[model samples]
Target: MDTLTNIRTFLTVVRAGSFSAAARTLDTVPSVITKRVDQLEHQLKVSLFTRTTRKLDLTEVGERYYPRFMTIIREIDDAFQDVTSSRHRIEEKLRIKCPTTMAIQYYGHILTDFQRSYPGIRLELLLIDRSVNPVEESFDIAIGALPTSYANVEDIPLCPLPRIIVASPTYLQEKGMPKHPSDLIHHDCLTFLAAGNRWQFQGDKGPVSVDVTARVSVNDSHVLMHAVENHLGIAIVASHIAEPSLRQGLATEILSHYPVPDLWVKALVPRNRRGNAAVEAVISWLKNASQPAPPWEQIPLSKITRQAPS
Candidate 1:
């Protein structure tokens, strides 16, 4: 990126005949222009311009390289404009990134739907817990659970990620049930402490955050779920996650009055390439994929019953 910026700077300075004039055009300081031109000269092993006390003149080498630089710059501009113009055109790679849990939980069907929607476009999905730069990594889009505020990245909420208080039927039966969020104090709350403990929620009275104490702490949701099923404690998890048990009557929803914050899944795209068609298609697809909420059977990932990988 700096290299490209430097090239443009050098070309501008040469065309303008002085660092001051170039700075005026580029809206940067004179020193910045000087460093960029100097760096560009050093990179090409030839001084691009001869600087004097009052006037600056392009060297013979500078004159020769100017056309080449302009040609390259023009090609880049044309290519970019062409790509931008083809916003509705199809038949290209649709690469996307997502968090592991989100990919399995939601996008499992979204991907299939995208493939079906755009058969000419090849879908490349990269799943990771850590967020990756879409532009830097050549990813077209991202579906992630965590929120980020990085430059050149923008987020659009895909769905509400409501966390729920879930404990397996066996566990709830043996240990009893929590009637309110505050009642978690008496239960063996099996939960992850990494994301924070104060589960803020909304009740009939308004919003409230309850500080929880966990008798059993586990990092992985899969493991924590086992502890929950075994009646080890109450586990607070996203609705999609506890869906299997909740629907099967294996797990029950607690504190329904104090609504959990909507845990949201977001689609992140390169800030610089927001309007690209390939990216736009996937973003639209992701938001619209689950027309009527998908059936759990359509997704094969284990929810509460997942032990160790088979």
Candidate 2:
């Protein structure tokens, strides 16, 4: 028996909790998985799992051995990555997580360009709206806006994404525009739940806050933008989310005199991943794409007639 392969199969089965699931992950048949596990058990002279119809449970020995095996596997994989990364060869798989709206609107081309530039690298991109702890989630990289301060991870600032108040022309026409931030209380606000229930603005005098009562409260910025476009109400959203509408003349900026606090587009990675070549390359590419003004701020509302890529 190939000890390494058998151990790998065993770990896979343990993680998957079934021979069938492990087989699917390993691209082998369930019987082959069972045989490998049986071989491993015979060699060790101990049963690793207590198998039952409903579930699989680890035996005492298995529980102790699992952590040791995990460390060995991780060290081996890291060794390979370290060697390849030193050569500047990004030939390994990379898992990335990002916001759904940003991924569709901005990163579609950036990712394509990166893939074309590095054909040996395989990419898996997962889109999510909520905050994610990259280390806890086992992601190689995470690209999104960090709403709050994060100290545990390394953050690379991509661009300034200031919030803007916008409303559809029809909605503004019907509801009338607010002259000041305080007047926003009278208008129906389409609010992003992530930004919280209050909107902040900096005017000539000082800062102002408006407690938002929403016509529609949503987590996704894109959904909130859609609601604004459909004349639901005025919304405070990221510049990128409002850009398409502002460009197409579908929505007009409100409270232009009051500037919102600047937000940012950021790239996050585990602290230990600072020197990772693949991740560094991605960060460099994203920084380049953001320079000379990012895609969101590049196109003037006057010139953009067609909708931006979804």
Candidate 3:
């Protein structure tokens, strides 16, 4: 029996959920897949899976062995890639998680460019607006505007997500503009669900927080910008998300003197993937894309800036 081959087949069966599915993934027949798993089970003198006509499930020993097998496979792949990377193109799979708004507005092209450059690598991108546990989700990398540290994950800072207060020209004309963070309380404020009714800022004095009333609250940044364009209310939004509107004169920045606190876009990598070539390459590519300044920040904001609050 080819021990390594049988072990790989066993892992594939576990991941694909059935012999037929594993056969399709491995480009073989169900009988071959079944034989490999059977051989692996016989070698170990234990049953790895409980089979039923309806479904397949792992036994307790199999559950304990899955992670160990995954680690072994990853180590072998990483070692081989590292040795050949200088001479040959990297061939691997990378699973990435990112926030929905950021992916649509900014990272879509960046990711596309990376894939174009490394045609050998396969990318699986999952778009979500919530924090994800990279290890638990089996993702190689997770990107977001995370403010706090997570255990067993290394947060590599990519760039600052500077934000600004914005309102439509028509809305500003009707409701008037906010001169300070405190003025927000009197306006029809739009808030992100994560931020609640309170908005944070930094002034020359120090940090400031204001409790404002929101007629509209949403979790998505793009929708919040749309609300601003529709003259729903004043909102604090990421500078990148608000850039196009600000440039096109659809939206105007308010309270420029009091800068909103910056959220950082970071690459959250699991500890085990620390030295992974593909992960490192992706991180480097992202950092390079943000260099000098992020694409949005690089634009001349001469028109976007409002006169300092009087």
Q: What tens-digit string does per-residue lDDT give for candidate 1 at 1-310?
A: 2777888998898778789999999998999998988888888889888888998888899999889989999999999887555543577886788766666656865687677766667888877766566767777787766545467788877766657877877777777777888777777777564456666778888887777887777555556655666667787776666766666676787778877777566777878768876677777777666434432334544542444432
Best by lDDT: 3
Give Cα distance to truth, residue 190, candidate 3, Å: 1.4
Candidate 2 backbone collisions, by pair? none
Looking at candidate 3, the ten consecutive residues that score lowest on lDDT are: 301-310
By TM-score, the best candidate is 2
Task: State which candidate, 1 or 2, has the greater TM-score.
Answer: 2
List, residue by residue over 82-111, the lDDT tens digit for candidate 2: 865654566778888888777766776688
lDDT of 3 by residue, 1-310 (tens): 8988998998999989899999999999999999988998999999999999999999999998889988998898899887556423778999999887667656776888888877777899989887788988898999988575678999988888888999999999998878889988889999887667778888999998999999899878878888999899999898877877898899999888898889888889999999987888888888998775874665433433433211
* lDDT for predicted candidate 2 compared with the true structure: 0.82
| Global lDDT of model 3 | 0.85
TM-score of each: 0.56, 0.64, 0.63
lDDT value, residue 24 of candidate 2:
100
Model 2 lowest lDDT segment of ten: 300-309
What is the alpha-carbon lDDT for the whole of candidate 1?
Answer: 0.72
Where does model 3 exceed 4 Å of error?
Answer: 1-89, 297-310
How large is the C-alpha RMSD of every model relative to the true structure? 17.5, 19.1, 19.2
**Models ranked on TM-score:** 2, 3, 1
Residue pairs in clash, model 3 = none
Q: Which stretches of candidate 1 lie over 4 Å from their true place?
A: 1-95, 116-122, 130-139, 147-151, 169-176, 192-194, 214-224, 291-310
